[model samples]
Target: MVEKNTTKTYIKEWQKAIQKEISFLKKFGGTRYIVYNGRFISRDEMFTYYFDTSSSLPIPIGSKIRLEWGGLKTNGRVLSSEGKGMIVALEKSIGELISEATLLHDPWELLENLIERLDEIKKSKQKRARLKRLMDPTMEPKHPTTRIKSNVHELTLRSKYNPVTFVWGPPGTGKTYTLARVAANKYLQEKRILVLAHSNQAVDVLLAEISLFLKRKDKFCVGDVLRYGTNSGQSLANHTEITSEQLIESSNPKLSKERTALLVERRTIKQDLTRSFSKRDSDELLEIETKLARLLDKFRQKELELLKKAAIIGTTLAKAASDSAIYEKEFDLIIVDEASMAYVPQAAFAATLGKRVIICGDFKQLPPIAASRDLLVTEWLKEDIFHKTNVADSVNQQKLHPHMLLLKEQRRMHPDISAFTNQYIYKSLVADHEAVYTNRNKIVLQTPFSGHASILLDTSYTGHHSLSEKSSNSRYNLWQLLLSFQLIYESVLGGAKSIGYVTPYRIQSNLMNLLIEELLENENKNADIIAATVHRFQGSERDVMIFDTVDAEPQSRPGMLLVGKDSERLINVAITRTRGKFIHVSNTSFIKKNIFRGKTLRQLVDHQMQHNQQVTTQKIGYWIKNQHSKLAWSHARKQSKVFQDLQSAKNSIVIAIPEGKTLATEWERMLAKRHPKVSFTLVSKQPMQHLQPNQWMDENIAFPFILIDEEILWLGQPLEAVVDVDPPFVAARLHSRKVSEFFIGQLLKE
Candidate 1:
């Protein structure tokens, strides 16, 4: 019997999650759009609308939408989207009220379908029993009769009794490759398989692998493997043959011809109906409309037949539950890749569609993206199936689980590079593959990291602070930006080919992109380098990985990248993406002081300090002087220090403040009295009352900075009150005469 309490709880939690998502979507200004035009396509029984393409949230094809205009709202589904426009199939038409409407992304259909499926499972005894087994945390797994082997793939292929199997795949463990092999093995046995993942990209990847493996085995056939849902651009470019559209078009000529003929007939009927309506021929119009409806139904029936015939089908979890035809089908085995990123309800719904389920993912990586902070929403919606099943807990406690297999051999990173994650994050559960050791000597480093496998580029002594961006929550550090760019520049100069710059903020990534572009343009050099957040660099690797922890300063606590529950996983991913060397740039002292809950980052700093070469400001300064621009910059904590340094100025001092901000009266008076002979010029968006017209100029500045005697430059927000009151607010001081004079010339030119 299905437990009423459990069923109700599942429904309640899923509803709460849906509400949370809707609230988040509205709060973020992602759902509302101003419609430019709307028209009805009577033949296809759909409506097309055009709107601005600039949306904060991406609206992929096949997403459900709702149109609100003229005191009316109708639900619809996005049929196609191109530049600045989209076609949608709405439930009903609002006649002649298409002038200026609102479009909202409605995800309720998918969530409601999931909840209905859960309810269906609750009503079925067999499904309820299966769910109990899958979710039971206290159930002990059957022990293996033979000695465990090192190859997890072999073990998984040999097992046949478990109804639910979990694969603990860490980074570089060939998880997707293993899933493809298993699917291939099942196909050879003539068992139907359904492959699902949390994202469309993951689905495409696995389907491509399956197609390749089947072809290698000489068992491949047209329409044997199918990619469902909208085809991604990358997949189409790489493996178009696996898409359902391509397969159907290539294999079935009769259906293609019939579809074309039906489309032509429908168009003719639509044209005829328009004329019939103008002539007041109601009977003729009704007959033409009836013919169009029949044709559309026939077309849909043929398409559904082609979709359901594939022996191996692949799609995302959301699509699997949302598409009615797909959700109704049954398979012998359901394999979920990246299961740890799947929502609990979505994963559970997938589990009910097959006789046996195989889940592959690493809980150590990112989970489902949940924006709600409510405790229940997070507990139900954000948690993955691995955590719900107690599989992760079992592996963590004993390094092994009977029902789950852990892939321990890593083929991505060198031993030196992987050791950090192996010891601290994975608790020595992972080891390097034999090939890594055999080919370890083949890897070589460049100039800055010539003889080192890892280095800690500590910026604590530089007095550089990470400042919050005015427009967003993201932060950026000027010192780390220059330091990271220099490392990349010098590394490229020394023949480094592939590099990955992983940071925690978008603002820092954007700045790095600009700097890298400038470097590439000036030097006329090319390299395979990417600057992105760790989330974007999850499944990618490079020859050299530069991880910049952008959070520093005492006033700002550790960012979510360092102190959250997934901080360890974030760090693990960052350090393990390198094949040759790893460079961590940050203020170690600040991290050490602020990070209280997580030990992964703390242990990482200590490990690097103990085992690797340390790069200090002295070495960085020397490198900058010799290789790149010859400028020396230092950090100061207070604006008062800039005033003290002004005592030595002889010629001119320029203080530029941002709009609506002014120089502190006390600092202005002190600087004037202390440096009487120094020419002081204040640049502001408006004329200041405290200064003479000759001493003040009306000009806009992005941030507050001071230039002293055309030789020393102070870069930071000096005019803000927080700079003086907060100890962590830092400003950079550069003592390069040429660089200072360049700035002075630019300011004085206008």
Candidate 2:
């Protein structure tokens, strides 16, 4: 056979290819064929009743024909040959079919059509067999572990090494509510279940939900399932309450105030750090930078240890049938909440804790640690593992594997919010079923609000904005982040009018402490809050949230940029918790630096007015300049539309930063001293508890000078950071000045 380029071949060429394949199959002995509504369907695919042992047949390969019967009409083609050299075909739908096929094939064309239809019938039979297996009664509602909801067609979400069935519901979608029902149903089937979550705050909510459904049974454990990432780990009950006292007890309770005092003393080191690198002061600057770095590192370790010691590590447990002592105390099934932000290895290991597992997480919220070299979602989906007999490579293959499902119906968030994410963010699992998902998930592009959520462009007012680089021993962006955090806090969360604040970065966490002190001294309002990484916020819901998608990467980075994967998970948690409103802030370039910055996100919705007008490069440029819009217009649709190219933006930003240059890719302190007043705010869910959130709320913070971030933009900073190495801190150009002013205010508060 001569082989040539077929890429540009029309559908008719594909038809001939099928005809040739069918002819070859005819030479061999063919199996009996079955007809469904006069259309060729395979006997193997014919269904008597659904069962665990049932199998499905394949559809016909390729031969175009239309069938009408039983008030149903469908366009189908001979897909392929099946069963002992017999040919078959499955119907390929082009558009929605509301009417049924009622007409019959003419008798004159009957035998001719029938013989040809044999192949089509054979393919249908194959497809039917597979569909039967999918609908197998035992595999459907009456399964050993699940309650079958007759009205819905279930798509089970699972993975090979990880047996967990993961589900994710947005805000107002009742993630906990759905979880409780699923857990209860599974538990009723005589399975020992473990319900785990990452956030200390989220643990509280889950425990409460379980308490309502089932009184704590000896066979069950639910609560703050502590995932001890540290080397020093321990075990405890699932729903153990953690308090400040526990932290003190974990360490020497006697050292409580002593540790706090040491942390306090480090604040004075800031003065020495502000100096520049000069021949006369270079030695002194180096000495001060070294001391500050050590102090910062030390404080972070001790503080984290304190938190780990306070959190509850699940029961003294192991899985069933495994008597390895460690695996001896086993759970029948395992369930993890707030899994999006979890490290892949930690989550995978946790999933294996039970004979069966269910994981619930939103990929859009956060992603796995890109730097961690471990088995993760993408890896698990792509790798092969031991089956009953052989290993299976793909989870989503034609043959059923008793694992893997995708839950696409999400109703917790306002349809708009969910739609935006599904459109501009993650798209793998969102469904299109009208019965299951009534709302069409329409989106209003470029809509920005102040109270709940909003998007803003580069807005500027009259001000002396300096782009300065911060001084640091390492080419990190700690200072830059610090300044940005303050500006965001005051402008968005609540200036002096608000009570709490949260920061995921350790450096910012430390700086927040310093700012709070000064505020309290000056008699500022104190609001308590939960602040940390997306991992910290996982499972825990909050009211009034703010997210900063601030990355220092230029226009060519991969994956998520300003927001770390774990941080993105946290940001997801933050946005979902806003019962009332949520706020999001990022460099005007965030979308450009991330996913929305690409061409794929842009769908051409042509100009509405007709003028026989054609859009040219020059016209497009004119359009962009006049509207200050980022996307191009297309000629397909009548209405003009803007595209959100998030993935492309992320890739571009990653590309802009040179590799191994920490300061270039990540935020730097010097940049923190640059801009002074570029800021924005968004709203989030209401607080779960009435008491104000965050300790920083009570700080007496203030500032006197206009701090600039331009101190280190062109310093001896590294260019591109290592792809897998820790990102150096990149300063928020505007925040340096704001943070400095806020620090002064905090100091004077007393």
lDDT of all the models against the reference? Answer: 0.70, 0.33
**Per-model TM-score on C-alpha atoms:** 0.74, 0.39
Tens-digit lDDT track of model 2 for 1-750: 433222112112323433333343333212322342122222233211100101223322233334433444443333222221212222532222212222111111212332232233234443223222221212322233355452112312132123334454444445665665555555555445565554434444554455455544543333222222211112214323222233333555545555455434433322222232122332332343345455545545654554333222222111111113222335666666666555332344444455655555555564433221223323422121111112122322433234433355554444323444444333434532333133212211111223222222120110112121232211112323333334334333332222223333443444545544433334333433444444445444443344433333322332232333333334445455432223443333323434442332111001101212222222222222211011112332111110121111211110112222223211333223223332111011222122212211222111111122211111111223222222221112121333454433332343
Question: Which pairs clash inside model 1?
Answer: none
Instruction: Report the number of the highest-lDDT candidate.
Output: 1
Give the RMSD in angstroms, all C-alphas superposed, for model 2. Answer: 28.7
Tell me how far the alpha carbon of residue 219 in candidate 1 is from the true structure, in angstroms, after superposition: 2.5
Give the Cα error of residue 411 in candidate 2, in Å.
5.8
